[model samples]
Target: MELTLDDLGVTLSRRRVLDGISVILRPGRVTAILGPNGAGKSTLLRTAAALIAPATGTVRLGDRNVATLDPRERARRIGYLPQNAGVHWNIATSEVVALGRLPHRAPFAAPGQHDLDAVTRAMAATETAHLADRPVNELSGGERARVLLARVLAGEPDWLLADEPLAGLDPRHQFDILDRLQEVARQGRGVAIVLHDLLHAGRVADDVLLLKEGRVLTSGEAAAVMTPDNLRAAFGVEVSVQRNTGGGLVCTPIGRALATA
Candidate 1:
């Protein structure tokens, strides 16, 4: 199922955080949202996932408006990983990951084999299987992030929406997560991530949405939309676009673009 967002606008405490945001996220592809800090990337992703109510427009999951669907049903179709992956309690890692299955369980019922299997698969995919017995609160930032990602994956949702998922991760872990998300898309699940790493977006995202000051600068194929001029326009930084040995696009910021308030 594709995620179709149309003319989405959101206001928080009388501040317009998102305006005229619209994009299509397709299955079998990874769409990365890129922007400067406070560019409303997180707000757009949350609104698309129905975590935030839009002041105007709509978010449709296939042909169904997500806002009109039951909460549990929406949870089953969309898995959202917020910017902060902190778990306040001293909960076991496995138990924390298992939380993804809650939407599928009957009221007060014990988890069935399906739930256990999904949790196991998710933990393994995230390389968190070894930490199953450890308390989540004791893990490092990257470890906890992986565990939280596992929690979202355990649900086997049709769409995965993650905010700043690469933050705090080491280079190796960052590569792992990006590669894993690509594999997820290959499995025909739609994946969208809020990313600041332009190189990673070039490396993994099939599509791109570039935003600036709560407005979309452009959106399209990753390579085409991430031009030096567009990057400079959105980020206020001059950059050089180069090609690596693998023919992958590499973005090197040269300097800040001149502007006066």
Candidate 2:
């Protein structure tokens, strides 16, 4: 199923956060939302997830309006991992992950074998099986991030939306999460992530959406959209784009772009 945003606009507290934005995010590929601070990357993502209502246009999931979906149905079909997701209660790591299966369970019924298996698979995929018995409140930031991601994965949603999912992760774990996201896309699920790391966005995203001032500055295939000129326009930074031995695009900001009269 494709997640489509058409002429989308969002307003928060009487202020417009996104305007005239549109994109078709496809399944079986990763789409990275790239922008500078206050560019409304997170707002756009939340709008697509139906967590935030759009002031104009629509977010459609394969012809069905996202806002029309039942809450439980929406939770089952779309898994959202917000930036800096917190665990206030001292819940067991395993229990936190199992929460993803709540939409699938019947009212007042216990988890079945399927839920158990999904939780096991998610924890293993995230390398959090070792921390399954630990309290979520006591884990390090990176560990907690992975655990929360596992919680999202356990639901087996058709679309996975994450905002800065790699934040606080070590380089190794960052790579691990990127690989897992690609794997999810390969399994025919749509994946969209908001990323600030230009290099990571170049490497991990099949498509890139560059946002500036709450609008779509440009968007298309990663190779075409991640050019130095586009980065400069969106971020006002001069950057160098190169291909490594693996033919993956690598972006490095070299300096600030010179102002034009």
Candidate 3:
């Protein structure tokens, strides 16, 4: 299913956060939302996930408006991993991960074999199965992040929206997670993530949406939108985008743009 944002607008404390944003996110591909801080990337993801109400326009999943869907159905289809998500409960890590199955089970029903299998796969994919017995709150920041992501993956939703998922991860773990996300997209599911590293974004994302303030600076295939001029325009940095011997893009910021009068 395509996640379509039609003229989305958001406001908080009477301040506009997103305005006139429109994008059609397709399945079977990864789209990276990139910009400097406070560019409405998180808000856009939240709106797409139906966590925040849009002040104007609509977010549609295929032909239906996301607001009109039942909460459980919505949850079953769209799995969201927010940035710095916290697990306040001191529950076992497996228990925390199993919570993703709630939308699929009856009230007060125990987890079936399907649920158990899903949780196991998710934990194993995240390499967090060994930590399953530990209390979730006791894990380090990176461990906790992976555990939370495992919870989302456990749901096996059709559309995955993640905000800055690579933050606080080591380089090895970051590459691992990126590979996992690409695998998810390759399975014909829609995957969108807010990314800060231009090189990583270019490496993983088939498409890129560059935002400045609350509006789109550019949105298209990564090769078309990730040009040096667009990076300078959106981030005020003069960057070099080159392909290495392996044919992957390597984006390096050479210097900050000179201030304009």
Which model scores highest in TM-score?
Answer: 2
lDDT of 2: 0.96
Q: In model 3, where is the ten-residue run with the lowest total lDDT?
A: 243-252
Return the candidate ranking by TM-score, descending.
2, 3, 1
- Which digits, one per residue and each the tens of the lDDT, describe model 3 over residues 1-261? 999999999998899999999989989999999999999999999999999999999999999999989999999999999999998889999999999999999989999999999999999989999999999989999999999999999999999999999988999999999999999999999999999998899889888989989998889888898889999999999999987785657788898998989
Per-residue error (Å), model 2, residue 131:
0.4
Between candidates 1 and 3, the one scoring higher on TM-score is 3
- Candidate 2 residue lDDT tens string, 1-261: 999999999999999999999899999999999999999999999999999999999999999999999999999999999998998889999999999999999887899999999999999999999999999999999999999999999999999999999999999999999999999999999999999999998889999999999999999899999999999999999999998787678999999999999
Q: What is the TM-score of each candidate against the true structure?
A: 0.95, 0.98, 0.97
lDDT of each: 0.90, 0.96, 0.93
Q: Tell me how many clashing residue pairs each candidate has.
A: 0, 0, 0
